[model samples]
Target: MDKMEIVEKHKLLSEKIADADMVLVGVGEEFNEDFSDIGRFPHLMSALEEVDIDQMLEWTVPFLEHRFLIEHNDGRLVEAYRNLYEMVRNKNYFVITTCIDENIKKAAFDTERLVEPCGNHEMLQCSDKCCDELYPSGEFSDLVKQAILDGVGLDSLEIPKCPVCGKPLAYNNILCEQNYVEEGYQRQWKKYTKWLQLTLNKKICILELGVELNLPNIIRWPFEKVAFYNQKASFFRINASSYQMTEELSDKGISIGMNAVDYLREYQHL
Candidate 1:
């Protein structure tokens, strides 16, 4: 959708949801991969061991997991999470995050006590020809400050060492990898589940933005059901290509085809 339309939609949605007591906003993964403003980084190709690069593209988790690992290790994940947390907290919105590593979420919350499980060995192992650029970790400022105290130039400063093992560090933000492990991730996930279940019955508007039906079961099916029984509820799916509303959903839901950010911006102006 164009900017104007998006803003208008968001304003309407926000107003519509204002009285609903609780609004469950499910943040999708990497909404637009091609958007450079979002930034791209190296991802570990775990499937390279068993399948070709062409075949690996069919599997979403491995590719995304790799990118998440790189982004988290570099501190981008922390910044994004902080931004999201602040936004939600300011609005007094009871936010729940799904499909994100628990430890990464914790680090984002704690801020000062950031830690990564894998050392540089994992990074070197995952580095491939296609993956060259490093995700900018916002933590670089702190590293630079430390380097200045030691009287070193930016170019001569070494990469930050891992606090856990005192070894060289790499981004440990990959999600859904077989080897991708995080402490306390499950605990946060359980909390999210509890919150979702507890908030299910109230009047809600399922604002499904840029989501596709064929993508993953975690998003599609549950949302479909949520929009089913909630009599005062509505489901709005905004997408460029896949735009359709079931007979039942159409009776109570509103589906649009457009860019989500543009819609939100338009609504803000309205």
Candidate 2:
């Protein structure tokens, strides 16, 4: 679509969401557009460039653990998210995101209202699944940060061991083929699903922001299905590309191919 068309669509989409009785936000990697150093997958891969792909899991543990802590502790959220958060702050809202950077928490969104289905990096568990516990990673992340700051190789430092089983611990994130312990995440998931049922007839808006087409089942497809069935619900997608909605949802869906941050900036002013 042309610039003028996009601008007009943004206006209508923003209005629809702003007037919504309930807002459901779906976020993905693109939500971290500005915080590339800590949240970008490419940047994280660069940090493990020396390691072979076979040892990616072994190397990524420390790198991702540290990045998680750094991002969680970072005070300033990207302007776009901050603004977007404000737009839906007053509305009854829930967030489902694939991002594990914890930016939503940093933006001061309520934890109970947010769900990270992909798992978060700030927690670690035993690789062997010896225990049902998830440990806070503050100490280990701090040690890794200090080692990097001192210009020392991480190889010398001992990998964090599970206190219960004495086995090496892994980042709690859901890596490929890895076991994911959903002790905490499950609660939020239940809450979101319950909210979905309770708000079925409400004036809802499923806002998909910066999401990619890679994992439609996670948020994209589900949002579309929900909006398709709910006559009062609207599905609005803000993406740089691949913003097309399915034909079934065409009546209640709107797609704008624009950067999430830019669109949020425009929405914030209105």
Candidate 3:
């Protein structure tokens, strides 16, 4: 199909979702550009490259400042989220995103209905796994700023420590590879599961956006499973590539092989 055909195909998302009693959206890592695009945030990249941290800084700094990093990504992602919310906000919908940078949270989507199961940088956990206690992610921000401003290694700075065993505190994101403090998102996870239970016999619209096989079980495979069983489900799989619908769900699925951002922008234009 040509560009116009793709746009027309994207329009079906809104029309199809309108028929569903509930909408479910799964956001995956492919929706996000990699750090190679970090040139847009030169200052942060400089800090990350020059000031050596023990470990978590490599992953945490970007997320710590993602309000700036993500919001300024040419406004494409933020606009995409807004476009998505405009379509699904009024419905009984739940969004589960693997993008851990909190960019989606910055959108106007109902927070109670959103879950980031891969974890995010909003909290901190003990580097030594000393306890399940969590702290605000910003507790060490000043120290990071000082290290960057002074052009010194973070090891020379006093970092926040775990209250229990006095080990350094680490960002709670799964990317940082700390014990990760899964309990942080369990409440919302439960909410998402409960919402899925409600969708079993109802008309559901499953929007699988930019999902790759990187974490298939989380969004890709499970979405296929749901659509396969729910006779009333309409599944739309959107990606730049790899948008093939599972065979069992072919009868009820649409695979739009286009960039997720572009697809959402098409909705915005409509």
Which candidate number maximizes lDDT? 3
Query: Over 4 Å off in model 2, which ranges?
Result: 32-35, 38-61, 64-77, 148-156, 265-269
lDDT for model 1, on a 0 to 1 scale?
0.45
lDDT of each: 0.45, 0.74, 0.77
Q: Cα deviation in Å at residue 231, candidate 2?
A: 1.3
Please report, as a residue range, the 10-residue window in candidate 3 with the lowest summed lDDT: 62-71
Clashes of each: 18, 0, 0
Show where candidate 1 strays beyond 4 Å.
1-12, 29-92, 96-172, 182-184, 213-215
Clash pairs for candidate 2: none
Task: For candidate 1, write residues 176-204 as lDDT tens digits.
Answer: 24433343234445555665566566666
Worst 10 residues of 2 by lDDT: 33-42
Candidate 3 matches the true fold with a TM-score of 0.85
* Of 1 and 2, the candidate ranking higher by TM-score: 2
Q: Report the C-alpha lDDT of model 3 over 1-270, residue by residue, as the tens digit.
A: 468767676677777777789999999866664555566766676766653644654544553364344335446677788888888878899999988777676578888998988777778888777778889866466556656568665456565778889987776777656477788889999999999999988999999998888878889988999999898899989898788877788788888887887778765634
What's model 2's lDDT at 56? 35
Q: Sort all candidates by TM-score, best to worst.
A: 3, 2, 1
